[model samples]
Target: MSIDLQSKLTPLPRLYKEITLDVGGEAVHLIIRRPPRTVMAMLLSEARKAGELDEQDKPKDGGCAMRLMARMAASVLYAPDGVRPLYDRKNPEVIENLVENAEWLLDIQEDVVGALGANGAVVERIQGNSEATQT
Candidate 1:
């Protein structure tokens, strides 16, 4: 006997983005997923610590931004070589490498988040076809 099972479709699909970097002249890509609610909470915590958030509902400047960016990159950036969680770096050499490339890492992270928001943004135009087209 054969059986089939299917679940109802969700209104939205998860989003993913890929960024390529030059590491030792070799191309490396970090694929990132749009962070879920839990992950977003974590990110906000880090941002608050880094002075990126404030009670006045504005961003503040602080020295911890680099560290926060590195940590955020570690959270989202996935490696093809299976090196996981750069935030918990134990290898001194890898830690140094990431520190040296902190700016680039932040750049990639921002790019991924930006693209995810820009491309995945939704719009509703009642006059248009109702196939859930985007703006």
Candidate 2:
């Protein structure tokens, strides 16, 4: 399952363009940068080379990696500068909606990743994806 998802999805780009959000009277702009593939590759390779899964109790199906990615994505999406407005003195509902959406996305990502095996490459891909949306 992990392999299939990895194959289906392309690696996220190195840097995503800046996005602007209207926060009350101010506009907040930010950019999400993709994590270096080398870093991800090294991390995964080290884990595999260590051959210490038994000691670490790492999931055989990359569950850990999936969760990490999901959480990371959720964090960004919920950030004040991300989807939700930063200082909307007039509207508080927008913030609530954004939080709800972010939570939903996080849950879905977790479920999807959990079903997939803990593949090093897939994990790396997810990290890349998270970085791509970091803004």
Model 2 misses residue 76 by how many Å? Answer: 9.6
TM-score per candidate, chains pooled: 0.50, 0.27
The superposed Cα distance between candidate 1 and the true structure at residue 38, in angstroms, equals: 2.2
Candidate 1 local lDDT, 25-48, one digit each (tens): 887776664544455446546556
lDDT of 2: 0.39
Give a tens-digit lDDT track for model 2, residues 24-111: 5576554343433354344344444544222333433444343334333322322323433122312334434443443443434433
Clash number for candidate 1: 0
